[model samples]
Target chain A: MIDLLVISPILVPLLTLIVCLIPRISAKTSDAISLTSAGVLLACVSWLLITVVSHGTLTLRAGGWAPPFGIVLVADTLSALMLWISAFVAFVVLIYGVRSGPDALSPGHLHVLIHGLIHGLMLGVNGSFLTGDLFNLYVWFEVMLISSFILMVREGHHSQLPGGLTYVLLNLLASALFLSGAGLIYGKLGTLNLADMAAKLGALQDPDLVNTSGALIFVAFAAKAALFPFHFWLPASYHRAAPAISALFAGLLTKVGVYALLRLFTLVFTPANGFSTTLILYLSMATMILGVLGAVAQYHIRRLLAFHIISQIGYMTAGLALGGELALTAVIFYVLHHIAVKSTLFLVGGVLEARTGSPDIRHHGGFYQSSPLLALCFLIPAFSLGGIPPLSGFWAKLNLLQAGIETGRWLFIATALIVGILTLFSMIKIWNESFWKAPASDHPRPATNTGGRPFLAMLSLCGLTLVFSLGGAFVFRLAQRAAGELADPSGYLDAVLKGGTL
Target chain B: MNSLLLRIAARYLSWPLLVVSLWLLYRGHNLPGGGFIGGLLAASAFMLYELSGYGRPQRGFFSISPFFFMPVGLGVAVLSALPGLLGGAFMKGLWLPGFELPLLGKVHLGTPLLFDIGVYLTVIGFILLLADTLNDESS
Candidate 1:
């Protein structure tokens, strides 16, 4: 029964998706299936987290088989926390999707793509957390990427056409590179389990093979996370996609890559592979600098947010690069804060676009006057994202800076501070242009309605962001424990060897 | 919009290209070629058809674009790992021992091969899908 909870969050949604595929089901029934599945998943994920906290670590071997044999789903505190947030956000987004009308996409097609994407994404995130295997992580990455592509194209708007092509091509190339890396590793070491591989890798004294294999794996994750050079396709595609769909991507998909980078760097590739930490730290700084610079240049509100996603991801990578117990803990806190804040921002931006009829900030003015409630929702996330005091985002940044100062990485600590300032600037730019100013053009405006169920849902998420600020000590402690666990890889390997005794 | 050379290429290259794609997929596990390249090859086959008859109403436009195939290929590639996940180590190949075939060498068949085949279909399918969209714009 306990093991069932581990798989239920994903399995239930998948089953509902299948049932919804029945062509004869009334639209009402389809909506019911979707809502019920989301509710059930959220409930199960919450329970799983509670159990994990009490029981140390939650492990389930799929179909009751043994190690290196059957697929396994494991949930640490971090995995459990992310699972809950991802599903909860999707539930809210689905509500927005339904309200937008059945014809927001190509009728039945939208439902299919949406359901498939949730299932795949949940599976990918869950697998990333649970699997003690390397190749399995790559497999989940592909699943998430494919599902995201379908969601992107479910709406065939002309603007999306070129970006869609680019997204597909670029992701495909990344998949290929991932495959080549996986293939090389499999050919060399006969086993693909993460814990097992780490043990074997530690035993091998030859530095060259270890470094080569380590770098190969790093390249694969770098491509997926869209670190700096590989990030070009994300903004274009994200800006072009319909808002709700992009919101989901903005929130969950890239985290899979970041999660992988964190899990791998901390656990398997430890004892300092000479260039690995420095390489990640150097890349993280560059990714942060470049990402923020790109965001500053973008005029479209949606595009700016997309660029910010890249830069914020850099912060997480940098924390991981710093490679200390406190730093890893900061990475966990930052991941949660960013997910919550980013999801809220994208959803609110979607609603704003819904009201203003354009994502261009220059075109949007006096929007706040028309929809004060919507403006309120946007403001909470905006200030939170800029690391305003008492907000969850501020703590995330504080921890990262603490990690940097402790590690004596003065440059990154300085970079983090500057990025925070730029983030404030960008947030203010939107506030000044859209919320406080007057409309610039005579474009027929959409009715700025932020009331009723949409209001309740958006309000609930906004309140969560605020509450997270004041009541984050428990999570901060859990994150610190997890990070400390990561900095000491022997604990992870010991857990596996001793049937998760740790 | 039709040209004699385009028709000749469509008529002659389609099946042969398709066969070459399958061959690439079959040898992909131990060789340089795999699903991505194979898919592109098969997509070119359909592009040939669209080229020969720019006016032809094909069965699908948006469905087969590399956009669609890209996702499908990725899904198949990922799913192929299920066996290893359940039975052995991650991505440990599921080898069905080669048996004698009518024309080919002892057929070296496995899940990776099947995954490669799926990749072949998806790449070809998605590429053609993208071409169809571009073709629609031109006309």
Candidate 2:
């Protein structure tokens, strides 16, 4: 029965979207339906997290058929953690959408489209994490891509189409590469079940086929994650989406790519291998430096944050490259911190955009005097994102640095530190332009009442990030446990394969 | 610019096309033809109707929004799986014992059939929606 809880998070949003889709469902009713479902989804995922903790790993064979033949949904510590975080983020974003109303929801059909988008996203993401079959993971990725592409182009805004085109074409290409790799793997092994693949690959001892397929899959995830040289599509398109949509994209979308990378590298491709580890290390460093550098050059707040997302991804991958328990732990912690901090910043950007009719920092000012609450929320996450001490980012970065030194990767360590300083410089740049500087001469007067809903959403997300800072000990322990689970997939293998035998 | 020939042909052909689509759908469980092909076949029938009826005011069944098919079909498809929940797992296929129909011989039912029907409706709905959108934009 607890195994059933795994699908609830995916089902709730989908059901809500169905209800909302009913002809003539009022926008208000639709929004109510969406919000309630999101809240329920959060509860379902929380229960899943607790269940996975107590039971170790939970696997469900769809249709009651055994695995290696039937579809399998497996939830270990890592998948559970991701679901918990995604559900929480989805709930907050839903509230933000509700509070902000029609404009925030965007396009015709209002709540119907928005909820449908969220539903598709949840289904894709949760399925990706829970699936034990490699091909099923690809199916989930397509599900996620289609839904997100719709969301990106939802408004039918003129600029959106071009951005949406770039986003769609690149992602489709990535999906093609991913499919080809899957086809190759299937051809070689004759099995698409991930656990089964692990068992088979370990036995087969063919490096060339494995490395080629691995590299192909890596490129696909890299494109999705927006790793350097493949990241131009992100900043170009992400900024064109509505603020709430942007926030959700900023929060969860790319992280799926990161999760896929982490999951594959740990489970299927061993870090002890030479070329793969070196490739991940160099790519991670380049991603970090280039991402923050792009951020430093941006004037639009959302574009700046979008670039920062790419950079933070580098940090997580770098941790993976470091290849130890502590490094993996750092990667997981950094993902958690980055999701909360990045989304909070984007929501803050939304509120700012709502209050002042633009996302351009040059057109905004006087938040220090007028909206102290917004200013405080902005500063906390901004500083945390910059790796200021006592905040979540500091602890995440410190762990990664420690992992680097322990691994004896001095050059990568230097790259991490340099990227950190540049990241701080960029954060300060946003702070100076948006909050610290005097109001631009033609800036609109700050409104006293900016509505409680968006603020509540921002505050709650910020509070989550703050909780990460204040309760660093507990969170780090959880990440440590998740990393341990990730580093060794035998438990996952036992659950899937042994469960099949029964 | 409406094609009188297409209109006449479509008016006579639509019902048979729908029947054929149903035939395809019925054979889909173990055969090559399934909900997807059936749905497309059904949508093509509707597409023919739209082409023949071009520039006329949308009336009767045609007037109903094409977008309606997408959500309703999706809902039905998703709900088809709920019966599987009753059986044990989320998508576990359950079957009814085959029974003789007066005219049709033996008939069997399962959640997968329901799922197929749902997909059929959704694909038809999506095609209609696309056709209608393009038609509206051109006008």
Candidate 3:
């Protein structure tokens, strides 16, 4: 029974994708199938989380083959937590996508196809989180990239083509780099199973080959995670996709990259290697500062939010760079908090665009006067993202800041603080222009009846943000336990290699 | 392109190619031949038929839209895993007891064969979809 739960995240989405692909299924039926599957996934992941909490690490060997030989799916506290949060986010986003009506970007016939792609995306995300092999992770990334590419360009608008092309080309480049890195690792270590690699990497005499491969993989994941130099594709492409897709991408995609970095760096490429850790540290500072500066220059709401996504990724990387039990805790906590807050903000931006007839804030006004609830919905996540106290983002940042201060990384700490301020500046800019500013003569007042399913989606996420805030201590403790597991992956290794019994 | 000799050859050769493809798929359990190669072989046969002025080959085995097979194939592949889950681990091959056949001596059936069949259909569907798209472009 527990074995089934471990694989259900992948299986549920896989089944949904198959169902969605059935010809002649109405868009409504596809919606029902996808939404119900997402709900089931969330329930299964939640149960998996409980099991992980009680059982330590759960590992399933495909075909019952012993690991170091067969493919394994390992779910530790960290993976389970990541899975639970992503499942919840996916469910809420699907609801928002359905209730928001037909996507303005694509035609009605494409609705079912989009759901199919979304399920594909979920399958990739879940597989990436759960796979215990490096090569398997790469395959999952391909699945995710294919689905995301279609989701971005399915409308085939002329304006979307350039962004879509850039997105695909850059990501393909990343995939190539990733494949080569895995190849290099396999050639040296003679195994792609993560636990086996971890065990062998420690015993290897010369560290240079491992470090080189680690650097290559780090660069690839940095591109996916939108780290400083490789972040161009994110701002170029994210805002051009459908609003719900942009929200989904913002919530899940880069975070998968971060999760990979966390898993590999902690487990295989330890700080003792001295290359990846230092590189991540310096690059993260640059990513934070540059990302916020980019956000400050954007007038388009979604584009600005896209830049903030990059900016916030810096904090997560910063926590990973800090390198301790507390820092890893902060990284996990920040990831959970950011996925909810960033996606909520994007959803609010979608609502704003739908109402104002533009994503440009310069043309928008009177939202506070017209719809206080929408305004409030926007404010909670925005303030939380800006790191206001008692909110989820505050605790997330606070934990990281504590870690940074403890490590005496004063330069990195200062960069984080400055970036936090600039993030608030950008958020306030959106507030002033879109909400507090007087209505322009050309501006249409947003429709007042914000009571339906769309609002329900927003309210549910806002409610989650509140829960994150109120339950910050509880979530932090969870993060700490997860961090402890990550900090010492011996439990994970034993679970996989020794055939952990459910 | 509409040579009578080519058309005659296509008509004679297509059925034989399909039979050989199925033989390959069935032999894949212990031998090297498998669903992927067999599916490619089967698709090539249809492609040859279409190339010989058949114009999409709409009759008998080729009547339905190739796109229809993708979901069915994927569904079958997923179903094959369920029996494995019931017995023990997922994707574990569970076999039916072997039975004697008239000429082949004995045959063992299993979920893996079902899985291979699913892959076969999916590959055929995928290739035909690509061919169909290219055909539309050219016309």
Candidate 4:
């Protein structure tokens, strides 16, 4: 039963994708099926979290193969938490996608296909979170890349092609690096199972080959996560997709990269290795400063939010670099907070564009007068993102800063503080220009339709952000437990290798 | 491209190729061939006939849009996992007792065979869909 639960997150989405692919299914029917699938996924993930919390790490040996021979799926607190949060965000985004109407984003006949792709994306995400083997993780990444690529280019707008091309080319390059790294590791250790590799890595005399392969894999994930030099693809392509797609991308995709970094860095490549740790520390700082600075210069709302996504990733990397129980906890907390807040900001940007027919903030004004509710929805996440007191982002940042201070990483702490301020400055830039300033004299505002499903999506995310703030202690405890599990992979290793209770 | 000689060869060769593809898929469980290669083989047979100047076989069985097979294939593939899931683990092969056949001798059947068939169908659909899209682009 538990084994089935472990695979349900992947299974549910696969079934949904298949159902949605039926040729003659109406868009409405596809939406219903996809939405229900998302709901079921969320419930399954939540239940998985409960199980993991009570029972420790859960492992499923695919085809009943013994460890080191066949594929395995392992879910500890970290995996479960990531799965639960993503499932929630996906469910909400599907709601927004459905309510916004099929034609709003996709052309005729492509709507059902898009839903199919969304489920495919979910299957990939869930598989990535649950897989215990390195090659399986690579396979899941391909699944995600293909689904997202089709989703981005499905509308066939000429404007989307360049972004899509860039996105595909860069990601394919990353995948190549990833495959090579996995191949190198397999050749060295004679195994691709993460647990077996971790157990075997320590015994190997030559650390250099392992470190070299590790660096290759790390670079691949960093590219995926949009860290510093590799961050260009994100801002270039994310804004080109439809709003709901953008929201989904902003919320889940890059975070998967971060999750991989955290998982592999903690389990397979411990921070004890000087090469990756030092590399992460420096790259993270650069990512933070540059990402926010880029955001500050953007006038387009979604573009700005996209840059912020990169900047926020820097903080998570910073936590990973810090490398302690506290830092890991903070990273988990920060990721949860950032996913919700960034997604809400993007959805709000979508709503704004829907109303104003422009993503450019300069041409927008007087939302404070016309749509106060929308204004409030934007304000909460914006403030939370900026780390305002009593909001989720504030606590998330505070935990991170606390972790940094404890580690005596004064330089990282100072950079973080400065970046936090710049983050606030950019958020305020959006607020002041779009919400506070009077309507531009020349540009006409379209008719307002503010009370619909898009608003519901944004509001629900805001509600989640509020829950994070109000329930900080509870969430923090969960993060703490998850971090503890990550900080020590003994339980995970034993669970996978010895085979945890079926 | 529309030469009568080429058309006669394609017409004579296509069905035989398809039959061979099914043979490959059936033997794939324990042998070298499987759904992917089999499906590719089957798709190529159709492609050969189309290239012989019949613009996409539109009569009888081939009239159905290749897209229609995708869901059905995926459904079959998913269903193949059910027996194993019920037995305990996912994708765990469950074999039925072997039975003798006239030409084939003893044959063992299992969920893995079903899974290959599913993959066979899905691959055919996917490749044909790509062909259709390319055709649309060219015309």
lDDT of 1 by residue, A1-502 (tens): 5555665665565455445434455555666667677778889888988887777666565544555655555677677777888877877766665534321423763555456566666666655656667777777777677777777876677788888888888878877776776676567667776766677767765466556766777777776777877788888788777676777788887787888888877766764533357888888888888888888888788889999998998999999889888888989988887877887787777777776778888878886887798789889888988999988889999999998999899999989999889988899988988889987777777655544655655676787787678888977887877776677767666555545432
Report per-candidate TM-score of chain A alone: 0.94, 0.97, 0.97, 0.98
Question: Which of the two candidates, 2 or 3, achieves a greater DockQ against the reference?
Answer: 3
Q: Give the TM-score of candidate 4.
A: 0.98
Tens digits of lDDT, candidate 2, A6-42: 6786688777766766677776777788888888888
Q: What's the true lDDT of residue A84 in model 1? A: 80
lDDT of 4 by residue, A339-421 (tens): 99999998889888877888899999898997899899999999999999999999999999999999899999999999999
Q: For candidate 3, lDDT tens digit of each residue in A1-502? A: 7678889999999999988887888877887888999999999999999999987888887877787888999999999999999999999888888734433324688878888899999999999999999999999988998999999888888988898999899899998998888999899888999999888877774478777888889989999999989999999999988888899999999999999999999988886543458778999999999999999999999999999999999999988889999999999999999999998988889888888778899888888998898899899999999999989989999889999999999999899899999999999999999999987668665553433666777789999999989999888899999999888888888898887757
Top of the candidates by lDDT: 4
DockQ of 1: 0.05
Report how far residue B68 has shifted in candidate 2, in Å: 3.5
Q: Is candidate 2 or candidate 4 better by TM-score?
A: 4
Kindly state the number of residue pairs that clash in model 3: 0
- When candidate 2 is compared with the true two-chain complex, its DockQ is 0.60
- DockQ of each candidate, alpha-carbon based: 0.05, 0.60, 0.76, 0.77
Pairwise TM-score winner, candidates 1 and 4 = 4
Candidate 2: stretches off by over 4 Å: A99-103, A107-111, A272-275, A445-449, A500-502, B1-5, B52-65
Q: lDDT per prediction? A: 0.73, 0.85, 0.88, 0.89
Clashing residue pairs in candidate 1 (N, C-alpha, C atoms within 3 angstroms) = A74-A130, A132-A194, B64-B125, B64-B129, B65-B126, B65-B129, B65-B130, B66-B126, B66-B127
- Model 3 clash pairs are none
Model 3 vs. true fold: TM: 0.97
Q: Local error of candidate 3 at B58, Å?
A: 3.4
lDDT of 3 by residue, B1-139 (tens): 7689988898788889999999898888899888888889988887877777658766767655776878888888888887888888887889999999986678989999999889888888889889999989998
